[model samples]
Target: MNSLKIVSLVFFVRSMEQIPCPCCGERLNVIGSRRRKYLTSQSLPQVVVIRRLRCCRCGRIHHELPDFLVPYKRYAGEAIEPVVANELPLSVAVDESTITRWRQWFAERAEHFAGCLESIRIRFGYGFVGGPSDLSLSVLQRIWHYVGDAPAWLARVVRTVANTNQWVHTRSAFCPSWQGYTIML
Candidate 1:
């Protein structure tokens, strides 16, 4: 089943009736809890119990993640910030290959994120202003402008884009192991 990630530190503390379903706009109900393990900014391991909420109207399950965590990423948001900002001498808990992969992932989605943020700005009736050629940096700058230079910037971006239904995610190919197999669409 496909599940949505809700980034909120006080998700559990808040009343379930107050939390609306991101997909269907229905009230959410507390379903269960799951333990998530991730590395801290210093590379130390930590575990957190996150709540699972269900939307009765849509029958969709949502994972409530803390602001420090990023969906599908094992590293803390703070640890990944330096890499996204292009800081030198990558130093973290993970291997070099992992860091390389993170860099590549951000590179692939940076432009899309910039475009989404731009669209949001325009949707709010803001005047159209030209963006920099370096859209990735521009996106980062805009995010900073919106949310300040907080350590949880990445998580905040994830949450924002996700709420707007513009979050980009990697998916498997249509034909995962199609060896000369063709089908009509």
Candidate 2:
């Protein structure tokens, strides 16, 4: 019986630790209990039983995982988008319905995930937000939108463009406009 409990613990951690506790801000301690339910699969509906977890500190129970680890799921957090896209063709990639679910889920939990990403960005630099070469477009857009104030480096770029003297004419083609470029800085 003790060995069985240990085995169940191992499996629960393996499957569910990808999500952290929403209230306590820590990984949940698996409860080692299973519930049976019918789940829809690609081909047909199937009955399955899944393990659930509860936070050790807050004691809030949850069955589904976090969204960052999952691509298009609101509950069953699984993979990042790049990993999913790598397996499938870019054109016929993950379903739009799944994407919509993820978007809604993230919006609902925006504060937590946004703070997590912002801390990483500030600690390791903007490049660390995604990566050097393959920065995710959506991530970049979110960073730009939520970063609030512009950094000194970006301000310098804006100043350089704004100080250019090509703007002698009111309607000159060579004039630098501060519309799109202003928001970047």
Among all candidates shown, the one with the greatest TM-score: 1
Total backbone clashes of candidate 1, pairs 3 or more residues apart or in separate chains: 0
lDDT, each prediction:
0.72, 0.40
Angstrom error of the Cα, residue 71, model 2: value is 8.6
Q: For residues 19-134, could you state the per-residue lDDT of candidate 1 as single tens digits?
A: 67878788788888888888877787777788788999988888776667777898888888788877777666777787888888887786676677667777897666645643
**Steric clashes per prediction:** 0, 1
Q: Candidate 1: where are CA atoms >4 Å away?
A: 1-17, 89-91, 126-139, 142-150, 177-185
lDDT digits (tens) for residues 1-185 of candidate 2: 35553222112223523666655566676677653322122222222344577877788776542112222222222222322223344332346775565455444444443445456556657654544443444543443444432333222222222222111213233545586663321
* Candidate 2 lDDT score at position 183: 30
Instruction: Evaluate candidate 1 by giving its C-alpha RMSD to the native, one decimal.
Output: 8.1
lDDT of 1 at 51: 79
> What TM-score, over all chains together, does every model reach?
0.74, 0.32
- Report the Cα lDDT for residue 70, model 1: 73
Candidate 2 least-lDDT 10 residues: 160-169
After best superposition, candidate 1 residue 83: deviation in angstroms?
1.1
